[model samples]
Target: MSDRAPQPVERRLPTEESRQLVALVRDIVSKEIAPRAAEEEEAGRFPREVFTLLSESGLLGLPYGSDHGGGDQPYEVYLQVLEELAAARLTVGLGVSVHSLACHALAGYGTDEQRAAHLTEMLSGGLLGAYCLSEPASGSDAASLRTKAVRDGDDWVITGTKAWITHGGIADFCTVLARTGVEGPRGITAFLVPGDAEGLNAALPEKKMGMKGSPTAQLHFDGVRVGDDRRIGEEGQGFAIALSALDSGRLGIAACAIGVAQAALDEAVAYATDRRQFGRPIADFQGLRFMLADMATQIEAGRALYLEAARLRDAGEPFSRQAAMAKLFCTDAAMRVTTDAVQVLGGYGYTQDFPVERLMREAKVLQIVEGTNQIQRMVIARHLAGPETR
Candidate 1:
């Protein structure tokens, strides 16, 4: 064998098709999403109509295969679209992310029969989805989840509570991870549970600090019966499937973080340029100018990281580390940028008059959800130094 080491393959830059997709998304964001965001935010109303509009535009299935009615767009393109949506409304962005996470089990590991029955509606309709993995006890440590799924002849009986479910009360379907074997990660299995299934209930939505339009509630499966056909992949593979989906889901969060930061920057730029102080626009002040520059820089950097991760995913490379890094860096950037954006608006930023306050609140949840920044740090640390360092 030759002694020369293998060279790393560089990812291709965004192609013409990708650029077109981005432009189309920008148009949709500007024309359809941007105008209604403020009204929806004020009313604390979830954007079912907007989602329906997106579905009609084929955005809901942006990254899936065309054979199943998906748009078959690249992850990079899909994430950019998500960034645009998030810039308009965090709830809508989150709805799309949760929907993608929900699609993972069915797309990656579902049997043909299961996909035939559900994937079509999931890809082509206004219906949304929720991923049910975290329990009251298991958030980052999902392998320790307590939900149970017992085989009952022709059906599987699922019983447990899933906590912090996005779209919990409003989703059309949920992909739930439940334990089938003895206690441990290996014991877990995934099941596709319909939202309207008997014995399944969602608690009243939780009061949250941000992303108010997005509902978060506890999903209770009390002896919920599902057909054996609804089980995704092999038994005892739920943990692996969940982790796989999370690896992908982290990119969505990273993109949303970028969007939040970008929105903050946009608001700050608009405000600073307009709001006068000391006989000049606040933006004319060097101090405010530097803050805006910093916010812009951070958003650009975060966007770069998430796009790199998405590129690695599209290239079929090992991307877990990249995804974790993107999630960590981008979310931290979002927190910082949004905080600075608030400072830019001064007192107005502190109040609900502008969107900065909401942006800040939305930025916070990006750090917590789709694996907390703490968990992200752990993941990145492990990747850098190896598990033996623990």
Candidate 2:
């Protein structure tokens, strides 16, 4: 016990439904998820039980409409749940985001009949889902993907490899982007490809630097058959759908970045109080104190940026540029916070004995995924100019 006051516990205010949902999520995370995060993350084990708990609690469907067995919650409320979940366990937070990405095709563009049949399961099922858009050749330039889907009368035969899918091996379904025309994005189409479809397979998991518990792999669709009815939207609308999904998905990544940063800050503050140096707590040192202050400030600013973006979305304002801004800023903040957290702990932070190292590793991916920071800057710059010049 060093003489630092107990860290203040403040939460963002929410609507009545959001308040109830947040409280329930907090309880579940504290009692169930937090205790196991370390073991599962270290062992690279997926928390299937946690996924079941989230579904049963109806958290998985928070952003969808009540008609689809979802909570009909606003983006504002739903993103807060994501922030809270990320605070407890990054894996669960990211899993939710990936699941939402998988469902975007259905929610945004699915036919009424398709929505009637799969929306509920997409939202509340214990099974996870993946978004398949990237390829070996088309990462930042997703529009240039080469995976092909050939229409065969009543069905489409898809043949392509989707790279860097978050829930690749374990997902129950995948929203796939495949090239159907000869040109660029105009040639692409989106489809709901069942995970168990014939000729569909996931490669063995890729060994990643972080987010070990969440699986990543290449999804191979070799002549996988899908009814034309399974097409998510009109041909050539895939690019628009994908971009719109990213507008939301970027916010999710921002929320997770904030959570990772907060975790690192929390660990740093705790360590500073307990660690002794020069006959007093290390926290009392001006050097360590300044670092903590900076970390906290970054986290606060990052939170504000994403919240503003979420508000813009809820208000039906143009938010694509803002979403890009939030994702770029918060993830950069996360990388800094986690790295400084390791510094605050000195030698111990460099080792696996502490969670900060893992958090640091996790932060890197946020910058890479959901559009790289470079791509985000490009998007923001283009938006800053008028359409003619852009």
Quick one: best lDDT, which candidate? 2
lDDT of each: 0.87, 0.88
lDDT of 2: 0.88
lDDT of 1 by residue, 30-87 (tens): 7877787877776778878888888887888888987777888889889988887898
Per-candidate TM vs. native? 0.94, 0.96
Q: List all candidate RMSDs to the true structure.
A: 7.8, 1.8
**Candidate 1 structure, TM-score to reference:** 0.94
Q: What tens-digit string does per-residue lDDT give for candidate 2 at 95-158?
A: 8988987898898899889999898888886767899999989999999999999989999999
- How many residue pairs clash in all the candidates, one count each? 0, 0
Q: What is the lDDT of residue 246 in candidate 1?
A: 97
TM-score of 2: 0.96
Candidate 2 lowest-lDDT run of ten: 1-10
Say which candidate scores most in TM-score: 2
User: Pairs clashing in candidate 2?
Assistant: none
